[model samples]
Target chain A: MSSNSKDKDNRRRRRSSSLMYQEPPESLEQQSDQAVLPNLNAQWVNAKGAWLIHIIIILLLKIVYDIVPSVTQETSWTLVNITYMFGSYLMFHWVRGIPFEFNAGAYDNLNMWEQIDNEDQYTPAKKFLLAVPICLFLVSTHYTHYDLAYFMINFLATLAVVVPKLPALHRMRLAFLNPEPQPTDQ
Target chain B: MNSSNIGTELPPTAVAFIESAAASFQKIPGSAIVIRYIRSSYQNDPIRSLVELFLFIFAVRYLLAPAYSTKKTKNVHLTEDEIDELVEDWTPEPLAGEQSEWEKLENDRIPVIIGPAAPKTKLQNGRTVTNLASYNHYNFASNPELTAKAVNTVRTYGVGPCSPPGFYGTQDVHMKSEADIAAHLGMPACIIYAQSFSTISSVIPAFSKRGDIIVADKAVNYPIRKGLQISRSTVRWYDHNDMEDLERVLAKVVKEGQGKPLTRRFIVTEGLFENTGDVVNLPKLVELKFKYKFRLILDETWSYGTMGRTGKGVTEHQHVDPNNVDMIIGGLAGCMSSGGGFCASTEEIVEHQRLSAAAYTFSAALPALLATTASETVTILQEEPSIIQNLRENIRAMRAQLDPRSDWVICTSSPENPVMLLVLKEQVVKDRGFSRQEQEFLLQDCVDECLANGVLITRLKSMPPALGSSPRDQEKEWLPRPALKVCVTTGLSKKETEKAGIVIRHAITAVMKGKKWQR
Candidate 1:
């Protein structure tokens, strides 16, 4: 009995060492669930007035910032550009999953950036989104009259958002900034 | 067309205004840069400039378009008089179509029980007849012990819950009942819904969303069919109780889904079929579920508290572990003679249903009295194994009287099923060449004849044509064979049950021999 038990243990060890470990079944199940339904997170970007809404938000931010006493056009423009960039980044890249629960956690592992167009690298929507920040930077720089301080700040804000959207960084998680989804109790 | 000629032809005020506009445009900042940019971009090509102008106009038109359009095609232009004439010519369909002749007859023939449903029930016609139509297989609805318990519960908790279970409607009794059922079925936990008919319907959509695959038996009861419709899940049907056909369908689904993402695949079936009154092969079903890695949602509404040795349901009867089944939906109103339904499964599944299942979360909790009665009945089933045996024995006696002895009809139910379903024999049907509607009419005649002979039974109730669906649409659906339902009960003595069974057999014979039914 002891020799048989040892033989069984050795076989188990050999099998474990021979094969490369694959992801847990849960991840595959989640992937299938994601495939079953179209991701709502990405589809909303294509909706009517979706592009217009971004322009409206930037305008609103400019107006609101301008209402503050003694604010200059340069300051207000830079603030609008920064605010829009931050909001877009939070909405598109930082959040990992949809706001709605109807899809059954299919998008839990993916952010809106990776979910758009089923993770295709460069669609029209993505291209339009990438152009928005760059245009805003140029607009802010022009309004600021190319002041070194404001131009640098606007450039940095644009870079912060545009860099993460590159296809190479798709589904890549930063260790300190964006950790993997913790296993839910369910 | 020359500038000098145009200037000379224009009025003095117009010419002066044009000159001022040009002067102001030239005065604007970065006007030279704008001209340079356009010149470089279009490269002085008139076609490119025209194209750009057209694109600009198109973008403006698109942006200005209305958000929602009702009609895809262009609207027809009609004169006012023509529109009035068309409006006058149109007629609206009726809200509900007139009931068919069969439906009217059925409505008129519904027997009104004046008192409690029992083995012997007094109908409005002032006749006490043997009642074999109710889901009171053990006749526990009128049991003194259960009645006392129900009364005690009512006194303590009142009649109405007044809230949904997710709210304050979940009383201590409800928890006790859930625990009792979970323990009785040897499952981890159980959740109870207010009504049995809507229980499975709600539980189905809770887990199985769109794109999820469901493999169901063709002969599942009406409630299950409704559940499948409401779930909107992809459904595949196999021949009823045919394991080979089920495996074939499962394998096909798996193959079709190959390399695609794994969906939540389910095998939805009943332990004892309510439509056909036959038992499912549970062991083989469990094997198939494991083999395919598909979860099993077993509706044990008819078999629970009727089939097992101590009435723990199909799992006990087949000696399969209850844990192997993903979800077990059972009716408390059926053989248990209480009200509501319970879904027993693992803790996680039950917890999920608490907030997800519509009938449980939206509807008021089951009344406290019914919960107490359900708890007590489950306990009685556990303590006294003979109640089930008594029911089985009565079933046997009923079978002996009707199944082998009847020449016109044959029992389609398994021997263990207390609800004995009698369908016209194949030879009888072939000889008469009866269609589905004719068979239903013949079964109704048998039920009426049995009632006149002081035996109360019912015909199998087929679902009404689904709302807004034509009879032609219903033709594609699988309809259970029209049959007479005779529910065996322990309330009656073996001799009495056998006598009623004989009366039923004679009733079928008499109906078949009647000149009105002759082919």
Candidate 2:
């Protein structure tokens, strides 16, 4: 009976140790390390690029408005208007990649996941919150009717480009701020 | 003959057969209420049952009796001389270079009915014009010459096709007209149909089947929506200019339909939204089509002969190669001074549609004279670039005048193309002297006022679906807002633009003043 009890005890002990080994270790050290290693500079660069494009658009509108009044004759004004409008449109296509949203596959990778983890360390909601003001500003500009309806439409169209990137940007910041808890074998 | 001989040899059972037939006929009640009420007084409502009985009797006697051929025929043999006389009386001489005999008779006898005539003082004043509600003669103001031209062409072509396109109806002019359109569009082939609505309804269904998926803009033409509904295909609506929505829907389609084959994936959209008067992002749409591998169909109804460097369409305007777009469907109704639609595509698509599209195969082709007019118009549009330039200038001038008055007006998009919407406020709506029934009446009034002052404008009624609101709900809410869409054709002059501006401003001022005075 003692030998049989001993065998039972050994089998139980073996199963417990195997389960322990299979469980992933909980390490605060790794979590802290990941949280601290976010690429803040790259995030700022993207944000700056977005703002730069916005400024460039506003500048272009100003340039067109200034130049249009100087042109003499209705025919020349019409020509200049068409040229500026088409030019701006082409410039928009060149600068912002024609306002197309990126496919999910473009961001579906381990690097993106790591970026998201790092991003979480910063204010996760910052990008989305920022987009709200940008959208409102665009809507207001559209309502103001500066540079005709095309400018307003172009401004509204930027939302399509900006909105999709917000989640990715937010997730990147979140990933940097908050690392997910590791599994524990209790 | 054998059956008749067999019947004659049979024993005389006529009385028995007639009795049996009579018994069977009696089983079906002459009046249905008799059967229902007689079955049970307590089971059914007597009044309801009586109405149903009356309906049943009426249906049987009138509707069913017509199919049974109850009329008896008595044959009367006529001699050859009598037949020749009959033929002579029936055949009337053709009314060459003049009104038909029937039309002449109708014209002579028109005072058969009369209503309360216009006030005598107003009629006498001439300035206070009592006949303000007539559009037939309004053509005199818009384009008196156009009326003369139309009449001359009708006189030349005669009345109608008299037969469908398949049977001695495809005129040489029709073929040549479509060929000319194809050459102008730089498309390999084209098929012109009577109307755009019919063309879309017929061709869209012919292209795809139940197994296919049609990805269209949420704001496409109503006929296309109806066609997709009839096609019984999976229809996915991408958000307006939202490529991400399209991509997501495409991905889902691909995932769900992994191994199973689909017939076709068609993406349909307009080159320019006729209602909003905004140019579509065709290049972006084409780019998505290329990336997602779907066939694209563009309705360049509003854009043709108006947009692009060569007046090709939005595709040409955006510098997108037309070869990439699978099919281009366009209408020559508004700017082209013609009344028909054409589908410009490869020879294969044209052949497929010709064989399958009910609109093309069943409807009568455009009459010879109208086809000639369209052909002439195309030549004019292609050869005379100044027409388009003048149109562009007029558009710019109008926009420049209207834009500064931001409170009262808002131009949606694109001055290059000559469609503008004059959006009015709630107060302006009240000022137009229109009831809710005449929601379009205000715009019509503006048009009339414009015509009275010597500027012609064509107005469009916004479809309920395109308004992006349910009609029932909108009606209940008393949202009577309507926009006046002015489509400037190629012939609009600089003087006309200035005159139009003055007239539009005056109309708005008058309405506003009228409303205030009424209050």
RMSD of each: 13.1, 36.2
lDDT of 2 by residue, B320-369 (tens): 87878888888766566667788889999998887677788888877665
The per-residue C-alpha lDDT of model 1 at residue B406 equals 89
Worst 10 residues of 2 chain B by lDDT: B132-141
For candidate 1, lDDT tens digit of each residue in B1-519? 246855557677887898898889879999988766556545445654564455345434434543332213487999999999999999998888798898899889989999899889999979999999988988898799889888888999999698999999999999999999999999999999999999999889889865578999999988888898767677999999999999999998888788555678999999999889888999999999999889999999988898789898899998999999999999999889889998999999999999888899899999999999999999999999998999999999999998888888889998889988899899999998999999999999899999999999998885656887877868878888889999899999999998998898888889888999998
Q: Provide fnat values for all models in the order shown.
A: 0.00, 0.00
Task: Report lDDT (Cα) of residue B369, candidate 2.
Answer: 59
Give TM-scores for every candidate, taking all chains together and pairing residue i with residue i: 0.72, 0.49
Question: Which of the numbered candidates is closest to the native, going by highest TM-score?
Answer: 1
Backbone atom clashes (below 3 Å) for every candidate:
0, 18
| Best-matching candidate per lDDT | 1
Candidate 2 lDDT by residue in tens digits, A45-101: 346465565446555655565576664333332333344334433332223111221
Distance from true location, Cα of B43 in model 2, Å: 65
Total backbone clashes of candidate 1, pairs 3 or more residues apart or in separate chains: 0
Query: Chain A vs. true chain A, TM-score per candidate?
Result: 0.80, 0.29
